[model samples]
Target: MASTEAPEVLRYAAFTGDPAGGNPAGVVLDATGLDASRMLALAAEVGYSETAFITGRDEARRRFSVRYFSPLAEVAFCGHATLATSVALAERIGTGALLFDTPAGEIGVDTVTGPDGKVRATLTSVPTRSRPAEAIEVDATLAALRWAAADLDPDLPPHVSFAGNDHLVLAAASRARLADLAYDFDALTAVMRTHGWTTVHLVWRESEGSYHARDPFPVGGVVEDPATGAAAAAFGGYLRTLGLVTAPRTVAVRQGEDMGRPSDLTVEVDPYETRVRVTGQAVPIP
Candidate 1:
């Protein structure tokens, strides 16, 4: 049974220090009495790309049980929501390390105030994996996106990457190609449902360590995500796996610029483990 009282919800934007930027997420720090149906209803009402509900907590271990939901359905994990929740927790309690028991796995997060006095959170994701997109899937996706093969970057091939949630990675040849994002929403949504993809990660590599990204999250009932931490983690894993970037390297991801809300994400990778680390600052949205 769920409580009749309305749960207190907090709104925060992740991957940026400015409230006007980044991806906004609804966070319910004390969702003890909420059931799955109630959680889903609250998430849909909030109208964010993703919302996080913390059901159980372990004070001794600083651990929490978290569930993620989009406007439409529940998801395995959501990185932006995790960052938002961590920042929310850090603001209330002292900032340090925290553990989250998500459906994907146990994720470790660290929060601290930077030299600029902004709260930043770093999340270590679960093990990640990637697989090349099949020809049929790619063809259908391309048709839905109205993108031609010539617009694709030759260096970065198409792959479906997973870091908690799955994303279809498509590297455009130029910044212009990436910026012009007018896709068939229903068509892409159908394809995403069929493949169980959270978002379509459209990116353009600017330099060896710098890249620009845009995410289409039709399944989440959102046209685009301002900042996508999950896709960023999966991208780091994909780069290391494909040897596009070496281990122990840091990649800078610039996103949401085209949408008027600019956000930045830092991705770190190592050769020793499959888990990718994503770091960014989050700000409360008043």
Candidate 2:
């Protein structure tokens, strides 16, 4: 049985200090009485890319069991929502380290208040893996996106990357190509569903260690994600797996510029570790 009463929902924008500058997410601090159906309904009503629900907590371990729901379905993991939820909890419990047991795996997060009085959260993702995209996968995705092989960057080959969730990595030959995003939503959704991919990580390199990115999230019931932490994490893994960057490298990803809601994400990759670290700032939406 689920509670009939409405649960409190908090809105926050992740990856940016400004409320209107990043991806928004709904957070339910205590979803004790909410069932899956209720959570899904609430998520759909909120209509964000994803919503996070904290179902259980272990005070002594500083751990909590969290679940992520999109407007259409439950996802294995959601990075932006995790960052927003961590900041929300830090506001109440003070900034510190926290562990989240998600459906994907255990994720460790650390929150700190900077001298500027902004709360920044860094999340260490689960073990990541990547492999070259199959020829069939690339052909189908290209058709769905209406992109010709010539439009893709030869430097960065297509690959399927995973941190917590899978993302198909595709690099456009030029920034202009990345900016002009118009695709068959249903067709792309079908392609993603076939590969169990969460999003298509479309990116173009700006400079050394800097890139512009866009994500199409039709499966999540969103046309585009202003900022995508999960995909950013996977992108880091992809870069490392392909030897595109040296070890102990940090990449700066700028997204949502085309949508007019700018977001900045920092991804750190280490030579010895398999997990990727994604750091961003989140602010409450008032």
Q: TM-score for model 2?
A: 0.98
Candidate 2 error regions (>4 Å): none
lDDT of 1 by residue, 10-38 (tens): 99989998999999999999999999999
- Clashes in each model (backbone N, CA, C under 3 Å)? 0, 0
The estimated TM-scores of all candidates read 0.98, 0.98
Query: Stretches of candidate 1 above 4 Å error?
Result: none
lDDT of 2: 0.94
Compute the lDDT for candidate 1: 0.93
- List, residue by residue over 1-286, the lDDT tens digit for candidate 2: 7888998999999999899899999999999789999999999999999999999998677899999999999999999999999999999888999999999999999999988898999999999889999999999999999999999999999999999999999999999999989999999999999999999999999986999999999999999999999999999999889887676989999999999889999999985778999999999999
- The weakest ten consecutive residues by lDDT in model 2 span 238-247
Residue 161 in model 1: lDDT? 94
